[model samples]
Target: MHPENTNFIYVNREMRTLSNIDYDITLLDWLRTNLKLKGTKEGCAEGDCGACSVLVHDGSNSEVRPINSCLVRVGQVVGKGVITVEGIGNEKKPHPLQTSFIKENASQCGYCTPGFIISGISLLNSNKDVDENSINDSVSGNLCRCTGYSPIVKALKSVGNNHEEIKPIQFVEQNNDVQLGLVSYHNPINLDELLNLTNKPNFRYLAGGTDLNLQRPIINEDQNTIINLSNIKELKNIEVQNNKLLLGSAVTIENFLVTIKDRIPELIELLQRFGSPQIRNQGTIGGNLCTSSPIGDIAPVFLALNAKLNIFGSNGRKKVNLNEFYTGYRKNILTKDEIVSSIEVPLPKKDYNLFCWKLSKRYDQDISTISLTVYIKIRDQIIDDIHLAAGGIAETPKYLDNLCKDMKGQKLDKSISLAINNIKNYIKPISDIRGTADYRIESFRGLFRRLEKCLVDGVKTMSIMDYNNE
Candidate 1:
């Protein structure tokens, strides 16, 4: 599939290839060993740490964004463009943030400087105005054992007013398919070609590598075949029809946030804590749902919205209700040959008000202890209709139909108290690294308390600081 000169990537705007390398090699390894660019360090191979952060252009029409090089395989970027720390700037002609870092004493251990610089420069080059919040979010994936992050924030602020133009990057022609070692990677540009390939057996769909790549058994193992869904334009569409919002499976979470900013301003705060900027830029909503993780953040909101999933396969296309999609822990109703094509979210009516909240140990880049979404319509100060859904409180994302039924026709305060007292009836969560089963129950109840206070008392900061006081 090299096609004489095509099975290579434009690394740092320079063509680079490893014709004999295996597909199991990570981009971090390839950058350090094969290409001999050791600037991009690898701290956490699981993509938690940003030591391996790099800017990547997917060879699509979009510009470059940050992602973890450790979680990405070389085969996945055959025709894309990658820019390591070295590509951004150097000591002689350093980026503005680089110089400011030294002046602010942002480099003590220096293990994370390159990654921080890379992430900071990406923010500086974007159309967004630089601020403390933006700078903090941009480098949230990075970890510094020293410097305490104070100098880092100050350094980034020093260059916040400066914006520079990045040189154009080049992309190599994409190989339709390639087989290396135990991994067979396929890049299909359209829906028909994708379906034709998945009609066979033992194939896995890859939208974003954020989740799958962390689990080594899921990628390049047991001679597995990967059908990459990112290149298909049909799976990346966003549309509105008949008072419903249609979101394609391959659309990144960052793009989803941008699209819904004006329409659903309520979700903006909850999603800002979705993940680090790198993850939000690469992880997709369909990928989030497909994993069936009990704590996956996006599914609860969809469940509350009465969303429907659009499925396409050899049998043709069909729509399935989101609440009925999950069967059990890490399980769904989709057949092996079928994949989620898109998600349809019904737009709220004039009388309906939606509220969503995520409870995590840390506010950003953390897994939820419990996630809650409440959609309510009030008529004459009585709750006419309400829908409640939550994550991390059960084996699957639980839709609280019984509780919704119980709370209807009740006042807001009465409804909240009744539901908070009855949450344990609907969920039986397991103890895990994030929290205990008992703690999760209380957290979800606390979210209901928060809903009551915010709506009735005009609480500030969403009452996050006074959580236990309730």
Candidate 2:
């Protein structure tokens, strides 16, 4: 514990500041044990169950979004505002969402009702006219043992359509721009303070804590000295510079979608299935890439787009292509001292054809069984450039450069046949829980065939949402 430092986090309407706090403690544990806010239940310690859902607002936008508390570290929300179920409404003054839930008989065992209420209220706070799809996606992370979703969905729609907009609790300004300190828990505000702490022995860097929290004692154990990278000013930027989209690695997935949705809608549609709204709120693009999961949703798209990542260490910074960053499954070329600073994506030309697909057991909040992305630039019905990447097929997400090369200079029909035959050279899928090796390979072949038909039909983009609608 560092006696010299004082950390502050805002919860409900109060500013809770403490000195020498443990940074690695899960926010759900703190809410239940320290604050004794029993309203926020804990069903699964992992992020799968949404019983620990709460509304969190940061200084960037002050817009409250629902996130699972069990997967968040206390240090990550030091300067942000958190609202639990208790803060939503009390017995004396019930929120409209609460009243709707009561009227619609949405509560079953009642264990998951608080989290569902928080999701409903947050949905109302953000969107006044949500459709059925939006309502379904909002509560995708929550799991109800009773399996009573019809009434819950009805309650959410009722609140979304009829409830009055309640003003969220205002955030308190905290001084987060302090200099570096030799503390067990570090919340650096600027690049210098963060860089200075990077090379220290056993110093672990944390972003959204969604994935890291699941690893528990392996990644962010109680005694480890952790540095919070979420609030650093340098890593929270998104800009277009020099004909490339430069995105900070620490940008939230939700924020990333907001910033680049217009430029790449097809990719955003695939990302929408990355996790539920709650998981995306607490997950970062950098964290997603750094985790180096073979089934990660964003890596295949970025690899196909020829994206590069900027890495910073105590010495200086270096940029590496996304295809070259990964060494193996759950392993990257990053040294112990280096951290990802930003991601650089070369903007595609106007005539480029981009497509991505995700196959999972469930439509929402599930990992990919097989993910594929294709980027092609054609002129006069002749292929000028092509890049393909696949996930959940190998130890790392890999670009099919050999296949792309084989398809170069060929017509759309000819390239289709070329890709189908050479696809096996690039990927060697293994049997796993999601699917068998033969199934994934067949799906890859089928995807190529469908891609050919879509190209022949003059399709510009392909999205699961669009496909479902069709």
Candidate 3:
């Protein structure tokens, strides 16, 4: 038996002081089975389905965003406030979004209703202006088989247009004390504690657990230790100094978007297509980079940005260029005790043009079949400095070093053709479920052709997928 403590977590203005709870179970299971809150349905155990969506206040920020409970572990919510579907409305009086759903006849089978309502509430809470795309993006993760999304979208518009002041139902107590769990769950307050904990053997560093949760069940091992890096002040810092932005590894993509919204419109457009709102709320830059997936949305962008990483370990700290970060497919040079602390992104010059594209089957919540990033400076139609990077076309996110060097001082049109030819020889993509190798190669050629057309003919910009007939 494990010993108990008075560590508390808030849910819907009511505080639940938990003791000796099982730390291994997911937040969805704990809510549905342990707490008997069955309103939040479960369609898919994975994060793809928004059926398990709930609003969580991280206790540090005033904004409350929706998150999938299926991907969240019970211990991850310590000192956080969670609001489920049950807390949104009562039998006597339903919430505004719930009432709109009823009035708009949005529910046919009603399995995905609660999730839609919760997500819609979050959308309204976060944004004062509502549009069709905004509503669709808000509930993109939710799927309804019986009823189409038209009525649901209409219902969201009705409730989301009202400018209402949104606040968390319960404010979690800000306790700086570390949470020691029955299992080896540790939340280090500072870098020293994190380094000390990492010095021990067989410990996994967990950031947001978006991708780690998917791997935990498959890689079933008796793993007892996880170092939570979300709460460390140093790891969550974002600074702008000397014409560059220094972003802590633990900063969520959502926070990063808000920070660089005005400064980097192109980057905002790219990240908006990264994942669903819920996943972006929880997913961090460090987690994305650490996974090192070939088709990861941010890898090519980081490569194009010429980013640098500040890595920490038991020994000390060291800096590494992002281009040399990945050694192989889904592998990096980090030791077991090393953790990425922060990232340095240089601001692009006014004369430079940065372009990013991702080709996938679905418009939302889909993995990329091919991702490309280009940073080029054109002076009087001659390419000056060109940096090209691509993913899903190599073992890792590859920087086209040879192609970039060859393109320098060449005419812009000739440089594009040269890069296209260089791709045929350099990139050897494998056949995957998302696409065929031949298909990827052809798509990239077409992408380059479109880029050339845009620069030469001054055509309006759209995704490469848009230009393709097939």
Top lDDT prediction, candidate number: 1
Best first by TM-score, ranked: 1, 3, 2
**Model 3 misplaced stretches (Cα beyond 4 Å):** 1-5, 163-166, 170-182, 218-223, 457-461, 464-470
The digit string of per-residue lDDT tens for model 2 on 247-330 reads 988898988877777887767778778887789888999999999999889999999989999999887989899989999989
Per-residue accuracy of model 1 over 219-338 as CA lDDT, tens digit each = 355777888888888999999899888999999898899888877777777777888878888799899999999888899999999999999888899999999999999999998878
Distance (Å) between predicted and true CA of 148, model 2?
A: 2.7
Q: Who is ahead in lDDT, 1 or 3?
A: 1
Question: How far out, in Å, is residue 281 in model 1?
Answer: 1.5
lDDT of each: 0.83, 0.81, 0.81
Clashing pairs in 3: none
What TM-score would you give candidate 2 relative to the actual structure? Answer: 0.91
Q: Backbone clash tally for model 3?
A: 0
Local lDDT at 445 for model 3: 87
Q: In model 1, which range of ten residues has the least summed lDDT?
A: 458-467
Reference-based TM-score of each model? 0.94, 0.91, 0.93
Clashing pairs in 2: none
- List the RMSD of every prediction in angstroms: 2.4, 3.3, 3.0
